[model samples]
Target: MAKAIGRGRGPTIIDVARVAGVSKMTVSRVINNEAGVRDGTRKAVLAAIRTLNYEPNIAARTLVTAGEARVGVVYSNPSAAFMSDFLIGVFEEAAAKGVRLTLVKGEDGLAPPEAELRRMAQGVDGVVLAPPLGELPAIRQVLSDAHLPTAVVAVGQPTGEGISVRIDDWQASHDMARHLLSLGHRRIGFIAGNPDQSSSALRLEGCRAAVDATPGAELIIAQGAFSYTSGLRAAEWLLDEACPPTAIFASNDDMAAAAVSVAHRRHLDVPRDLTVVGFDDTTVATTLWPPLTTIRQPVRQMAATALELLMGAIRNGAPAAGDHLLSHALVERQSTAPPNRARAPAPALS
Candidate 1:
């Protein structure tokens, strides 16, 4: 029996062939969108692919017949969940296009050195930048000086920053704050993301806008590194304050989960004694005792789209100055709720 591809795993051509009840050659033709196959057979193959969520390794398929097309990716994110999603998107897209992807980890999310970047750009046609690497001027200068086409994901604004793709961090964070506000959370504590990433400022701006617009709501921010330890320290600081806020919002899931842990240590009931929310709906969001309410950034889809755009730029041999804005959603779970009156004070009148 052929083992089916599990969720988050790539489906093979043979697997598609079995589901479509067609030969492997027919499945290949369908994937290549080539003519000569009967309409009925083509439809069956496509339907099977859709049902299985199949993503073909296009690079492998085309390597024998066409010249190699390679794209390099530089990333430096501390969260394993975030990195996993981001790479999956890029690789899936690369496979679909039959383009080879080479990944290089940046030191602290910044490209290594000019010589290293020059070497990396030698055979690579283009590059994909992941924040905060994408936000670094030095990295951009290195790639730009090397004449390498590039795309960036999760950047704050378009800025014509080398074929950028991102969701509106400011809007998403604003909506998150609005959800908490609607739930009667007035004095909200925010843990800022790494200052090196542009998304951090944008998220802070969005949260601040929502808080400022609401009557009698107060916003207190703590510096964070977008890491679990940072979240723990920040949460501890907030909880230790004489007048700690009724609700806490961490910039990312790692920090948010850490904040939950801190609350547990303090003997606070989640969403009861203290409400907590996180940014990315990564794996950690649901692993907590009470699942986290968070903003879903669509990291995987964004990564995929960035690769697609980067491939185009590589083909054209010139960087494209364009912005591909993807969508974001606020995922509600058990982690957030109205303020606990006994544990915290009510909203102050302006």
Candidate 2:
């Protein structure tokens, strides 16, 4: 019922500046992530914003600055656990950087509508693509064609020209295979991911290299769609074979956990007649009673580094310097052991 001018419907930076006793420009600088704002000034502006619950008009600011303070994050992964964890990491960093993050949800996270993806970048300053399969062919065209900056996170290989954040997946997977081989597991089995995925190929390469390196280790292979039930189906097929592998490595925790279920149904004692392992230290690994052995991917670090790198490129128009690769560690748990001598040798399959 009062006038609309003084105590308006929404709070503004002018009110925040008035509360902080600073110029509107100073408030703008602090909100826009300018480097010149002193720590004291920044603190005061932030306090004023909090006190007033002031929200900036991002659309209006973009019109003035000619760009949006948003960084797009593109992710492609089937596991809900993986997606959620990675997003949490990304959002945490974005909040610290004062950049609004825009997510362009591609169809089922597949590479499509490169043009639309690029247009999605029209207002935003930069982007980060997560993982091997996340970088669809369309992604490259959009970023390259527009000369927009980008950072690829958790990618196995450097994109050759842009900033990237990742771990040595080959080394991590190779180490997991070694863990099984060290446990005196000779006849191991593999549940591979979809052939279309590059991570699937790299991960398998790691398994092959590890087994081939061992003096007397053997592996039988089966392919699946990277789903838990897919892992179950493949594990069921391999476990029923006359020569069941003593140990199995699923490309991810989802599948590896499935293998555990299959083993339990067959009344085979885990780590006795059968053993299982998974990559990516996801929550699924710990959901099992005995847990799983896997590689602890630096998910949070990767996401943060990607944000840092993308911010760098957005400000500089060129990719950031040096390597952004992180390291991985093997998380050993109760799911593996040497083959049980009492168990029947794999019977020859018909």
Candidate 3:
């Protein structure tokens, strides 16, 4: 049995173990999110820790461990806004665990090739991959061959052989599309992310599902590269169609912001003349004149969770292969409204 601690004395791992009816090592494993511990045992330890308000002495533990855990995070997406938010979360968690995080961007503006990724995995204990990087079969094969622990974040579907952290992109996008349909916008234009990314197909599917269920709703899709510039061009093309949509849904906040710019160039009033909604409620979502209506993907939390998964995999000497699903939200702002009474004239599609 563990005795109650006096003031100024923090709850220790032994206290948690006693309360959880497990050994001290079990408590430690739970705190570090290490594998090998049974799920039921892990939960009991966690519950005990929560009850005791326990905080692990991570720095001291790192010293005892001798070697620092090295994690490589690979990304090649063009959304600076998304990356910034993600880094903040990853950095916070990495610092807490005394783990080192290295960012590697591909030279070709895509996920690093298998050879390049193999080089990155040489020294690192584990890797965190984002988007197309996570979706690459070659990257998965090379990392698997290298015997490195891995976590995939923000992917449509995790390769099913490693830790995957993501929100429900399909349901989130579907909800956003329903929001537009509820607002009386029947014709919606969609600007897609890079087709190579799994999110592109998943999000598009969600939007199509919503539109299909609504009467008198029509969807027009424009291919995009998931860049602000791509959003601008895609929005231009959409607005120039034979019958332009009254609402535009861009797959990301960066593209949505670009859509706002295009609307302004055409001298159209947002929400009143054209409504725009975006996925990923990143900083760009709020920075726009009319704050964008979007689906909040919990970018920071997802990254933080991915880092945790990676660290645990490193400590346990096993790749954690499981889907970690987080929550998402629908954020309504000034950028959306019911369709205007009089529709604007359309130009050429190209």
Candidate 4:
């Protein structure tokens, strides 16, 4: 009998494989009673299991090996609040399914190098790609070549090659813009998110469509990188203009918070002199002096749904290709109100 190593937690499938002198896959096959193992190898694996006292969970037997099924999550987003919520959902589902997660951080919203991606593919059975990183064509091609199950979260549209989990960004933005219009905000400042993300363009288009449909409505666009600093700069630019907007709509909560800060610096009271709103409805939205009125994108739910899709594909031994559109809601709060008529910008000269 092989000596069992002492682990502080408990005996794992890896320990069983080590004692049996076989691969982890072989141990998994034995545990699940799958065919293709020689009688001698099977007996050796069973003996090792008995010696180590290993217990396999249902997820382990039905899906891939519990300890061996590695799923990679790649992200390069700059928003801490959004990432915090997303990671929570992922970890919860992964723990429940008895799966291991391998996190890979990309640089400046770009995917890792081809060589690094290839190396990662060898270790992971599937991958979950967060926004901006999933929009890259090279990254998609590389993963497709590897034949790994993949799930992309928060993209504007489904890529059709992998599982996509997201809210309808265009419609959500459109609804938010319409809400502002209904509040009598004719001239609204629009702060866009990162250009590299497909959601940015779709969101901008949605806001534009809403503005164009309403008579006398005008939109002043400013670029943002989905960071607090970028939001500050954009808000300052919009507020310093000859005819400043009465209301400002930022693509995310961080930018919206910056707009509120700029309003305060100018001695403007929120929803009195300036109406501000944002999207994503992250924690920052409510932590401000006046809670923000914005769109709830369900970030945590989207992450969990993506992980579930990836795991299902891994179990079925096929690529997961479908779009899962989650529901979004317009959350009303104290930050948005009817634009103060006295503070409205002067009409442009004909």
**Which structure is stronger by lDDT: 1 or 4?**
4
Q: Write the per-residue lDDT of candidate 4 for residues 105-177, one digit (tens) a residue.
A: 7776768888888788656767899887788999888776655668999999777878899999999999999
> What residue pairs clash in candidate 1, if any at all?
58-95, 58-98, 59-98
Per-residue CA lDDT of candidate 1, range 86-189, in tens?
99999889889888877788654556676777677654657898877787787788666545667888888655757899999999999999999999988999
Worst 10 residues of 1 by lDDT: 312-321
Model 2 TM: 0.76
When summed lDDT is taken over every stretch of 10 residues in candidate 3, the lowest stretch is 59-68
Backbone clashes (count) for model 2: 1
**Model 1, 215: alpha-carbon shift in Å?**
1.5
Question: Could you give candidate 2's per-residue lDDT for residues 1-350 as a string of tens digits?
Answer: 11122654687654564566544445566677777566776888788888877788874344325433567787776677777778888899888877788887654447646776766655455677876444465677766554456677766556575677777767788898888888888888999986766667778889889999888788899987677878989998888777778899998888998888888777777767788888888888898857888888878778888887777554432334345768888998998888786794343234
- Candidate 3 vs candidate 4, lDDT winner: 4
Candidate 2 regions with alpha-carbon error over 4 angstroms: 1-68, 107-109, 320-323, 344-350
lDDT of each: 0.80, 0.73, 0.81, 0.83
Model 1 residue 116 distance off true place after TM-score fit, in angstroms: 2.6
The clash number for model 1 is 3
Candidates 2 and 3 compared: the better one by TM-score is 3
